[model samples]
Target: MTDQRWAGVRQRVEAAGAGPGSGEVFGAWGHKWVVEEPLTRGELAELEAQTGVRLPEEYRAFLLHVGAGGAGPAYGLFPVRRVRGRWRWEGDGADLADLSRLDQPFPDQGPPRKLLDDLLAQRPEEEDFDEIEDFDDAIEAWDERWEAVMFTPERTSGAIVISHLGCAQREWLIISGSHRGTVWSDCRVDDADLVPLLDDDAVPVRFDRWYTDWLEGAERTALSAP
Candidate 1:
């Protein structure tokens, strides 16, 4: 019922994705294409629903391309890789393709914790999309002035990278992984307003990372971190 707006589109995507081993699918703009197989319609719907915000129309169009052209180096959209099993790209500095993949084996070694540090150190010869990093740093710097928590855009629909500051360190909350865009933010509101939207039995839960992962999706996840 929640997916009624995109039911026709979703049906088409689910039909196409019905294979034996599809692992993931990328959807945005108006086009839905399978990224990996073996995934189910329910799972994909959950992924779409997780973000709260819907994907942008233009973005879905690009997603229909589905890495068909290899996510070119100039468009700044082609340089995506998985982070912590989630797809992310900061697109403002250094070659990030090798750094974006999260499922690569650590084996007996260790996680590439230094990957960000390393990327920061290198100088990419291409057009600098590193401005996205500058934006992230700005978000981190400005998050200390709030109380309770604040989402970049509080309670609404459409594409937005929500930034919720609960503690000192910031968390990135992403609603959906497709649109890769950010919304604005709003100050504190009474819980009574939000409570009405909740089901009777649904316990209030915390959403630090999911509220802030827009940067991972839209390159502005840390916009509200302290």
Candidate 2:
């Protein structure tokens, strides 16, 4: 099933690449391609083994049949090899996944909004400020707990970042748990919750559906546009 779907997607992409205005479509629109050769079955297996997790079917199909990286939404897809290092947001002191935990089941429930509000409300009142050092100490303790809750992977457990969509937007592929194979967008910095990408029918879109939808649109737009 995955093979057939992927083949159709590739056909559409290749047909579009040959169409008029393809350059404009790729350059200006959401679609682009680094167009590397696909990975072999052995390579795919090695990646799963190293991560201690099974690759979701469609995503595994993507890495094996599509380009091994390069050319995807926003900044393009992340190569399997690139996932091992600290993520892009790690330097910002944001909580994020370490390579060791990528295979673990993503937490079933995300931290609730009310819980976050409560934590923020816990900030020491100004009247509680006694000595300068005491206030500083109190603040630091609060910051630690806040950061931990904010960064904990419970909400996004069993997922790995697949693309950095710029502006703190990102795409993650869930690898473990019930949501495995589903793709989600991380837009929390914008005060938005992580959202699942859905197809036209409102079904949760997996990697292949998401990728092909983008490809099909790019083709049609390029061929039809003036």
Candidate 3:
């Protein structure tokens, strides 16, 4: 997708009270970006079926109505982050970057790792959809339903794992349990906790202007930490 498409969406999001990406709460590392689509039940099922990841209850609830733009949860807005400060990341999924390696690492992984795996993939074919070229395109198409990560024990040399979403960290979450018994839960990014990450005087930048400023020097010091 062209940057033009995202540019329009970004403006619409900011106009709709979305904040630029900040390290605030569920904000991405640097610039804040709005989630392209608000997740729904039908969408959720599609993602689960495709990735074989049973999303966490909290996340599923959040997706159903929370944090989405316009007075709902899944409130798509990720806060804009600052240069340098002390921040604490807690939870089992916090440093789980290496976990994606536990996956089968292919497009159409055959089945999960249980007897149910065969049963799960046994459903008859439905209407087909064309796959996109990459993540950005998938987002542009508002195709978040296909967003899932799948891995297996024999393939990953361990257990089965999955994630309902994928991000830049090379991170993959296990939405469901693995045959080897790995399970995951997502931690909420609390505002009371995130506010302290910034100095008392951190200022907001125009959504259009923040990302460049972030790339120039604002994020340098922040990225220094793990």
TM-score of each: 0.22, 0.73, 0.27
Which of the numbered candidates is closest to the native, going by highest TM-score?
2
**What is the C-alpha lDDT profile of model 2 across 1-226, one tens digit per residue?**
3476677555556666666767765433433544556778877777766667777888878777766765555555666553464222221112354556767786666678798778868976657887888888898888787767766656666787776666777777788887788888777665456778887788877887777766767777667756
Ranking by TM-score: 2, 3, 1
Alpha carbon lDDT of each predicted model: 0.28, 0.67, 0.31
lDDT of 2 at 218: 74
- lDDT, residue 99, model 2: 53
The segments of candidate 2 whose C-alpha lies over 4 angstroms from its true place after superposition are 23-32, 82-97, 119-147, 200-202
By lDDT, the better pick of 1 and 3 is: 3
TM-score, candidate number 1? 0.22
Poorest stretch of ten by lDDT in candidate 1: 190-199
> Alpha carbon lDDT of residue 16, candidate 1?
35
Q: CA lDDT of 134 in candidate 3?
A: 52
Ranking by lDDT: 2, 3, 1
Please provide, for model 3 over 67-166, each residue's C-alpha lDDT reduced to its tens digit, 9 standing for 90 to 100: 2222111222231111143211122233333333333332223333563344335432323335434544534443222122222222233122122112
Residue pairs clashing, model 2: 106-157, 106-158
Which scores higher on lDDT, 1 or 2? 2
Number of the top lDDT candidate: 2
